[model samples]
Target: MEFYSFNKENGKQITKFNSNFVMSRIIQTDEAAHIGCMYLDKNGLVGYHQAVVPQLLLVLNGEGHVRGENDEYVRVQSGDAVFWAKGEWHETKSETGLTAIVIESDGLNPSAFMKLK
Candidate 1:
């Protein structure tokens, strides 16, 4: 699988709302959304499974490996974002540990802002 990365370092600095931070655009869903924080410890894993809806995993801390239908793992670290369409098979694992934000909805369209790596 190919890599997909989106870090705040690549985002625009916010001068309109505030001047102290950079904002990385993740997703904008018009439908109802389910957002949650996920933590994977050393040797942790989120087993291969089909996505119930359009899902976006935004890495917030540490690093990990992720795979889609091909079963090939792609390295991901802080600022990386992975998207899986509804019914797509995917898995995530980390040798060390990682923390991330997961956003799931039917209207997710990450390509609007995030570039594939």
Candidate 2:
């Protein structure tokens, strides 16, 4: 698994048309993509399984732990993004609740836009 940042610090400030905000790019897929929000309640867990396609998990709120092929859990929180390659084993868990956006696609290539964490 690889970690990326989607925090405001990694985004581009937009001052066009009198708008003031930072835009953090996520992904662009050449193929079909599945995007969804994941809500993990306290003590919740997403069991270990091989990714059917490349996956990117973007933390939206709260904190949690993630584990990849090596089975070493790492802490993750809001603004953090985690990537797992297709066929890689991974899992997500939270002891204090967490919410995230999950993006899956065979054409995922996060490195092209996201900054490494």
Candidate 3:
């Protein structure tokens, strides 16, 4: 069992993200799972990117908008969750600031599940 807190201030910042956004990696495992937090200050934006693995983003505070491959943007707020499939291109931005949790798992696949006989 593991116990941890998602303290924004304690996390290490990821320099790979766009200057308009802040990303912190909280946890990464050999099992191909990783967890992180993203913060977008007012008027901040994350440029277009593609997901190499399945990812889920859960809003923890504030609000933002996300755009997918279709180029359609959708509003998101605290408590909302968004899913991005592998290879999907997406981006995010906030006019009023936003905080979110990001979870990614490259090893999690439907084929890994087995049915009991």
Candidate 4:
């Protein structure tokens, strides 16, 4: 068993899509799976982008809104989970700050597992 925690003082600060956020990598495997924690400050925004791989965001604290390519926004709060499929465009914004667990993998293609023999 392994234990993990998000340490703000130690997490990597990343700026992308005009947003500033912190990420703490919990686990990353050569198999293309990644698990991490992300922190977004109040009024923080993650600009629209497409997911190269499948991704899941599990909200742990605070409130936020998620928008998809269609420009529709959905309210998200603590305990909410959102998923984005590969190549899906999405964005997020935090009105009251947000903390979330993120899981993603490049190996999530279901077509790759089809046995067409």
TM-score of each: 0.91, 0.97, 0.64, 0.64
Scored by lDDT, the top model is: 2
Q: How far out, in Å, is residue 21 in model 2?
A: 0.8
Top-TM-score candidate index: 2
lDDT (Cα atoms) of all candidates against the true structure: 0.87, 0.96, 0.67, 0.69
- Tens-digit lDDT track of model 4 for 6-89: 345435788888769877443333566788999989898888999878776767899899977786788887756676788889
Query: Number of clashes in every candidate structure?
Result: 0, 0, 0, 0
Per-residue error at 93 for model 4, in Å?
0.3
Candidate 3, overall lDDT? 0.67
TM-score of 3: 0.64
Q: On TM-score, who's better, 2 or 3?
A: 2
* Candidate ordering by lDDT (highest first): 2, 1, 4, 3
Q: Write the per-residue lDDT of candidate 1 for residues 16-60, one digit (tens) a residue.
A: 855777777777878999999999999999999999998999999
Q: List the candidate 1 regions with Cα displacement exceeding 4 Å.
A: 1-3
Whose TM-score is higher: candidate 2's or candidate 4's? 2
Those runs of model 3 whose alpha carbons end farther than 4 Å from true positions after fitting are 1-30, 107-117
Residues 5-114 of candidate 3 have per-residue lDDT tens digits of: 33344344655745443343333445667888988899989888998887767678998988888777888776566667789898889999999888788753322221
* Residue 36 Cα positional deviation in candidate 4, in Å, after optimal superposition: 1.2
- True-vs-predicted CA distance for residue 13, candidate 1, Å: 1.4
Clashes of 3: 0
How high a TM-score does candidate 2 get? 0.97
